[model samples]
Target: MTTTSGNTNPASVQLSAQAFRDVIGRFASGVTVITTCSGGRNFGTTASAVTSLTDDPPMLLICLNKSSTSAHAIRESGTFAVNVLAEDHVQLAGRFASKLPDKFEGMAFEKDGNGSPLLVGAIAHLVCSVSEQVEAGTHYVFLARVEDAVAYPGHPLAYFRGAFGRMQMAPDASVLREVRERIITTVNEVDQAIDLDRWAAELAVGVDLVHRALIALVSEGLVRREAGQFVIAPVPESIIFESYTAKLAIELGVAESTVGRVSQGQLTQLRQYMEATFEFIKDDRFTDPEAWIQANERFHEYMVELAGSKILLDTYRRLGLPGLNARTINRSTYATAELLNDHRKLVEAYENKDLGAVVEVLREHADRPRQLRARERELFGRA
Candidate 1:
């Protein structure tokens, strides 16, 4: 609506339009693909502006640009369905938001009760009959009565700053800690089957969430899947030592191939990670086990990444040295100076492009873990 008064300033009116878009664009909204059928044809477009109008009347409102073909179709058909997208539907949302000639081509969807296209895997679907519409400047606002609505279990897709993403809620850290602690203490016997349901009930978490944590444990080499069940993985000295041996070989190869050839930027990053390697053992004493292993892995990983082999990097990571370090070594008594010096020497050798020194340092560094493991047994009185 425009007020045609002699007092109306044209400049102010023009400024308001641009100001309005800039202001409203910062507010995030859930993504939806509005669908309708008209004249024996299917029409769909991705929509960002939608809100529940009233629950008592089961009505909702959606706004689309005046040029939207789907909006015209909805008006003609007098019905539409708003398919609220799941987080995984970023590509689907983009496809519909484009100017493609056939947006619905090769897409899997079913018709809602009102005969509007309901997208598969959507988090929610609302079938509506257009009750009224208003033309507001460059957009059309449709107020509809929701005839049928159903919602599924999933996270919603979010639109912000002209980009598509997810509205994520990070899992509680305490829950993760509890799950890891419980699994480590209870599943002492190697190959013992893990009871996810019992853990969920005891911990007051969802079974699916517990299962997610189990997968994380598996990647950390703390759990193994066998016969369609999760089981405690054996992390004896032999297994840990074998992983060290494997890591040693891969690190040598990466160093020999990469140290002399690394760019200056890579060199700077190497130094950064090398300095972090001792962050957990700054005062020649072990402070945080998790921080120690993470720092240790980051430094070694920087070396391996310099080799530029995704396959090699992936193989090195699958060894799960960080997790194994936590399991094998006892805290409060780990050798720290040796690790700190080894990282320092490796960085210095890389700076000088001395491949021989690199290999020499890595070889000696590999033996330190064995020495530490022995020291750990002696100090903690654990065989």
Candidate 2:
């Protein structure tokens, strides 16, 4: 939208087109070229004005000039496919932007469920059914409901004004370590999503560091590369439970410190961990001893983080046998109701700040479970 009359405010002033272009070019945005075919004909063009609109009803918005032939076809047919371009598709980007009569000439592509033509080997692709078309000035903005999508692993292609750029991928170990350190700082210190460029600059590193970090995650199966975007793998419920139980055990010790000795800073961290662990799951009372074991694991993880004792956390981690056995027990045994009751008692003790109660509760919560399970097995004639 544009409103050009004159600068109305004392502080507001207009810049020349050259200066304006230079200023706007500083912004780096992902490049997406939308394509569609109806009645056996292909049409597409490069565009950068694309963004996510909503999640409830999977939507995205893209703007095109009303005069573009693709816009007419999209409006008439009510279907289009969005191809998210990677840095490697610079040639495709240039080819599509031209007024060539046969844009699809010798180009490889596939049709999705909606019968929409999608460019093959793209970073990612989405086939959508047009939902709404709004006329804004000289451009027609189309909001579409995503019908199907697929993504591949690679670096996203970026465009700034008229120039194309590729993401830096670092390979050096020291550079990667530095990048991770800066990433941690940004995540903890900032409330907003930290800009990757600014973060790298602050660390005196290149964008390669960020790229390498993503590559490492992808290689380890900790993340996925699709359509030129990096996606974090979902944490499994078992893992979540294990982490919580471990945290709770760590925090139990910290909670035992005298009231006055527990400084305001430590108290803040302790409460945060407790509240975070509490709200993680919808159900606090697990169904069985194994489920309880998982819950216990997650609960203790938060506790450990709040304990503020790196030595304790590291020493505990080094005892691989304990953790390995704990995990084995979680997957093999079915938890009983009594185990959950013990967990509730432990949390109550910690919340009350009763040092003796906390210690007693934790001891039983940890050691009594195996005892109870073994008693039940013996009674049932397992031995």
Error in Å for residue 359 of model 2: 54
lDDT of 2 by residue, 1-383 (tens): 21342666635666567766676777888887788776677789888888889977899999999878788878877898999998899989998888899888898888877666788878899888899999999999999998877899887899886799986554678665554333322212322333557656776777767667757645544346666655544323344344446644655556564423545665555454444334322332233434433445555554554556789766444333233333334323434555545556655555566677767766666555456456657766442
**Model 2, residue 314: C-alpha shift (Å):** 20
Best candidate according to lDDT: 1
lDDT of each: 0.83, 0.64
Tens-place lDDT per residue, model 1, 1-383, is 23433447666554455556666777999999999999988899999999999998999999999899998898899999999999989999989999898898888899977678898899999999999999999999999999999999999999987788877554456666667656544423567888889888999999877777777677767679999999987665666677788999999888878877999999999999988866677454577777777788888987898999999998888777776676654456556688889989999999999999999999889888788768867877856
Give lDDT for model 2. 0.64
